[model samples]
Target: MTTAFDPVRIGALELANRIAMAPMTRSRAHGPGATATELMATYYEQRAGAGLIITEGAQPSVVGQGYPDTPGLHTAEQVEAWRATTDRVHAAGGAIFAQLLHTGRIGDAALLPGELIPVAPSAIPAAGQVYTHEGPKPYPTPRALTEAEIAETVDDFARAARNAVEAGFDGVELHGANGYLIQQFLSSNANRRTDGWGGTVEGRIRFAAEVTAAVAGAVGGDKVGLRISPGNTLHDIAEDDVEQTYKALVADIAGLDLAYLHIMESAGMRDLTASLRARFTGPLILNPNTLPEPTGPDALSLIEDGTADLVSYGALFLANPDLPARLAAGGPFNAPDRGTMFGGDQHGYTDYPTLT
Candidate 1:
């Protein structure tokens, strides 16, 4: 039986272990052009013990950014800035993937530059507030993307994937989970369109499929990965037919021969998880739904049972830089500092002690 510490092959790369450090938003991209900072490089280097390190979501386009201080890959300077982080991780014998995310309608206008507003499949406004640099503000009604803009957005993802490779990342993961742009299009409530992009299940999954294909084409299918949440309702997203929608979407892209399919499981979706896992023949990385409590070391057994090829940990890896080492020993893990989890200094970001 394989364990979390076992080696696994993901696409053209071979990871040293099945322990992956999940992408997390630390909101500390304090570089020019929303680029990554040297501190961010240090943070990633500290956690290089993991088999893979998926960086925080970086917007593919300028308008794709929904939060302050989040990094982006839309500019040359941004591409150059990320090199430091990727180089540090590689030098430490770790593989890294840049997660490209676009917040369709979950952002506040205050976070955007100039008079630009958010864009989604439709002009509908999601219920809830988004945290801005100024304060928490209500989500604004996003402008519906014209068919031409939709095509352009797809191109943007492809371009970003190329940029990620140029920046020295092992691969790129499209953020189709956590109520982002891709999930916005997949949501019945969020995406109420009547064009080729929405309405029918086929239409709704079109944008996601196109984006994936484009990115895969830009940076070989073997260098691409996608993250999705089948039944997640975060940011007021409602999916009446969760299983049917995701099943179709996975089937649509399964032929791409992607590097992996990452599922951020929601509550009571174990059956859906198994179904999707069986549908996609590629490696599967699971961030299981152990809500009310962050994913713990116990999830490693999922690998031994063949439930997932690799298990991802968020909060656990955040607090413990050498999380795999601690898990191997089976004790003495550091608790994540809730208050300092986001938008802070080295105290909570890279100051976590390792069992040296």
Candidate 2:
């Protein structure tokens, strides 16, 4: 029988344990596209003991960037930068994946190079101003993407997946949540298009399905994963029929042979773990998430009950570099300072010490 802590195969990859390093944004990219610095590389290398590590959301293209200092896989230099990090993790006997993200309406074109109009499925602007290098600025109304343009965006993800593999990553995860482009298409409020890309359930899901197919084809379905939140209302998203919307997505993507379906049980929504599992035939990684800082409330029990194949943790990994050791030993954790959570010195980034 398979246990949560026991090694299990997800698609073509086999993991030593079931604990995963949840994808968290650190915004430490050394300016330009996705140029990860030595410090960023070391930060992930230190936590290689986990069963899996999912890096912060990486924009597939320049216009996809949400934060000022977030990383990207759109350039040759950026791929080289990530190669060092993935090499380090592989040397440490770890498996890692890059989360490909496109901010879409969640960003401001003014903050991006050439003021790229921040395209989305519709022209609706995200509710709030995005924090940029200069400061927070009101989000500009995104120009709706033409049908041909939507296809181009899907191709961008395929190209990024190839870039991720070239950068030495084991696999790639499609960031389908938190108000990014993928989620925008799934959302009724954000995506009001009447064409092939939006309106009805299947229409709204067309873009995501195409992107998933594209990435899977580029990087092999066995090596690709997707992260989603059913009732996630972030970034001005509003999904009317949460159950129906996600059911279709889970069913449609399962045929692609994805590694695992990562569902984030975010705030305000009824627990979706059971409902989501019904549609997915692959391994399931559950994020029984809490506030900014996570307290799992017997997170292991979910695995014990067979509700999830693995548990991906976020803030806990932020404060404890050796998160597996701390969980195994039951040691007091170091709290991450809010000041350094975004972008700054290594104070809150790599300075946290492992329990000795």
Candidate 3:
């Protein structure tokens, strides 16, 4: 019987176990705008027990950032900042990848400083508020990206991918989930363009696929991966037909020959893997939200039965640095302090106790 501790090879990276540390944004970067801090590096080095560590969603450009202190990868200074962290993780004998994300319409006017109007697939403003430095700001009406601008954004993602490799990351994961730029393009409610990017599902997914191919070309196909959420609407995204839209999109992504496919597993009400598996023949990384119970044996069993190639844990790994060992020994895991989940000092970030 294969246990969670079993070593697994995912893409260009290999691990001692199938357990993975999901990319989680702590919003702890001191100087914002894509700059990584020493605290951030220390934070990652402490949690290297997992088979793999996918760093938090890093904004590809200035406008791609959403939160107050989230890191970016569009600058030389930012790249140098991240190199420090990656060097530490490598020295610890751990491998980590950067997850590239574009917040799209999730941006607040105040958060982005000069760029008040965020660019999205369409002009529709999501029905929600955004967390900003001062407070929550109502979702702003985003500008519809011009055909030229959309292509440039895709290039921004490609450039960010190239920067990640230069910064010493093992690979880059394209974030096509959480109602961001890619998801905004994927959502019919958000995308109303008649141009090459909007009408048909293929047209909408073209941005994501093209960006993936470009990044793969820049960083090698073996060093690229993508994460997707077919039915997620975290930022007021609306998908009319989840089945058809996702199936069509995945069918295109499946042939890309990238590293792995990360699925932010939602509810059992929707059988996610059933259709997507047919499209993507690579390793499947699963991230099940613990809406009720936190991560437990049942989640691991999915990996055991080969339903997923890897299991990604978010809060669990945040609270327990030695998460793999804790699970193996049936540990009393540390409960992550919700108040400190996003910001503050290193107290909650790296001070979480491992199993004694």
Question: What's the count of clashing pairs in each model shown?
Answer: 0, 0, 2
Write one digit per residue (lDDT tens) for candidate 3, span 147-245: 898878888998999999999999999999989999999888899988889888777787877888888878887788899887787889887777777
Instruction: Tell me which of candidates 1 and 2 scores higher on TM-score.
Output: 1
> Candidate 1 on 247-341: residue-level lDDT in tens?
99999998899999999998789888999999997999999866444455568878988889999989989999999998899858899998887
Clashes of 2: 0
Error of 2 at 31 (Å): 4.4
Least accurate 10 contiguous residues by lDDT in model 2: 290-299
Provide the clash count, candidate 3: 2
Candidate 2 lDDT tens digits, 232-308: 88888999788888888887887898999898887655356687787788989988875344454367667778888
10 residues in a row with least lDDT, candidate 3: 289-298
Off by over 4 Å in 2: 1-3, 267-271, 291-297
RMSD of each: 1.0, 1.7, 1.5
Q: State the TM-score for model 3.
A: 0.96
Q: What is the TM-score ranking, best to worst?
A: 1, 3, 2
